[model samples]
Target: MTVLSQEKPLPKAKTGEFWDHVQFGGGFGISAGNDYTDITIAPSAIYNFDDNFALGLGLQYSHLKQRNFYNSNIVGGSVIGLFSPIEEIQFSLEVEEIHVNNTYSDLYNNIKKSFWNTGLYVGGGYRADNVTIGARFNVLFDKNKDIYGSAFMPFVRVFF
Candidate 1:
């Protein structure tokens, strides 16, 4: 008497299959008021390893002005990881490092400051198609040095 085992081998991916799983996403914002103006642009690219996991890189640039009070520019980069346990929900972890440069001018003198800030964000959101809307809290937020005024921030993500 002899016993045999039966198992099927996994199929190999096609050459163009990699491109099908690649996605591009980011955020953009512009706000103008009587004494304040803010503009931001961030672009990112992600590669999906499967239906549930993705990793990506992003670049960000922001310009802010508050009339005669101050003028600042922020430039940074981030690494983000995303996981979807189900079709309607997604979780994310992102790490960002940014350089902040500011110039303050008054009737007496002008002062310049430059520094770097790091942020670690963990969040989850509702996912529909290529968009995700959620709020992320920064674990490493500091009031004196951080760019954002608050540790909690809302985000809208879109990928094409």
Candidate 2:
């Protein structure tokens, strides 16, 4: 008599794609001196669509105080996109709009004013496993309200 044996098939593994659909990141910085003080907090979120690209949004809040002359608040939002062709490099583009409100209180006078700032930034940088360091230029820079003094800005990003 002869006996026949049967083999069972292996089960498929989960890709973890659904759990990794969203990415969160942000940065914070502060600068202060005798005549002026500035603090900023920026938070962002990105939806990973595929392996190489993502679409996202960000919000920025800034508080500025200039000794005894005036105080200002800046609130802004950005539509951001990122592309990575390889494992170690990335290219980013963002469209940002900022609203600035300044209140002046000096001697016996109190005044308030508001303004809008819009810019487009494009840049590329080196990327690590969970961090990116880069420089970007505001192609659509406005001379009236560009606080950075120039069109070039440096950035460091951490991913979670």
Candidate 3:
């Protein structure tokens, strides 16, 4: 059997009505507050399964060229979980890592060194339409015990 009917095409729903969604953006970061500069060109993606459950992934590649500091290369990713306890507010947990080179300074030319950096972060944000502002605390532990070993990094993110 064959049947044909004519009807108007349905319009897409607004952001509030969609059950699933994705987001993409670029990111840049630096190690210290300021002494040298490092940059990253990153693209991040997010998918929401429902109002209270979501997942995300992000990739970043960084290049460090010596102007007055040591040169290095960095690459990384993040797997994120998003949940809502109350309306318009969401919580997240991220597992991420970065790799860089170890340079022997003029002061410590005879020392042999290597490093691999890793961390986990937990944060939350308030969502308004498509934009969010949030804060995170990252506990970073470095390999070089000779230098400053570990510290906590508190940073804020603006995402859409």
**Candidate-wise lDDT, in order:** 0.94, 0.87, 0.64
- Runs with alpha carbons beyond 4 Å of true place in candidate 3: 1-20, 29-36, 66-68, 104-113, 139-160
User: On residues 1-160, what C-alpha lDDT tens digit does candidate 1 reach at each position?
Assistant: 9999988998877989888889998889999999999999999999999989999999999999998889999999999999999988999999999999999989888899999999999989999999999989999998988878999998888999
Whole-model lDDT, model 2: 0.87
Residue range 56-133, candidate 2, lDDT tens digits: 899999999997798999999999899999979989999999998989988988899888888899988899976899
At residue 95, give the lDDT of candidate 2: 97
- What is the Cα-based TM-score of model 1? 0.87
Could you give me the TM-score of model 3 versus the true structure?
0.64
Which prediction has the highest TM-score against the true structure?
Answer: 1
Pick by lDDT: which candidate is best?
1
TM-score for each of the candidates: 0.87, 0.80, 0.64
In candidate 3, position 97 carries an lDDT of 66
lDDT of 3: 0.64
- Order of candidate numbers by TM-score, starting with the best: 1, 2, 3
After superposing candidate 1 on the true structure, give the runs of residues whose Cα lies further than 4 Å from its correct spot.
1-15
The Cα error of candidate 3 at residue 107, in Å, is 8.6
Candidate 3 Cα RMSD after full superposition onto the native fold (Å): 6.7
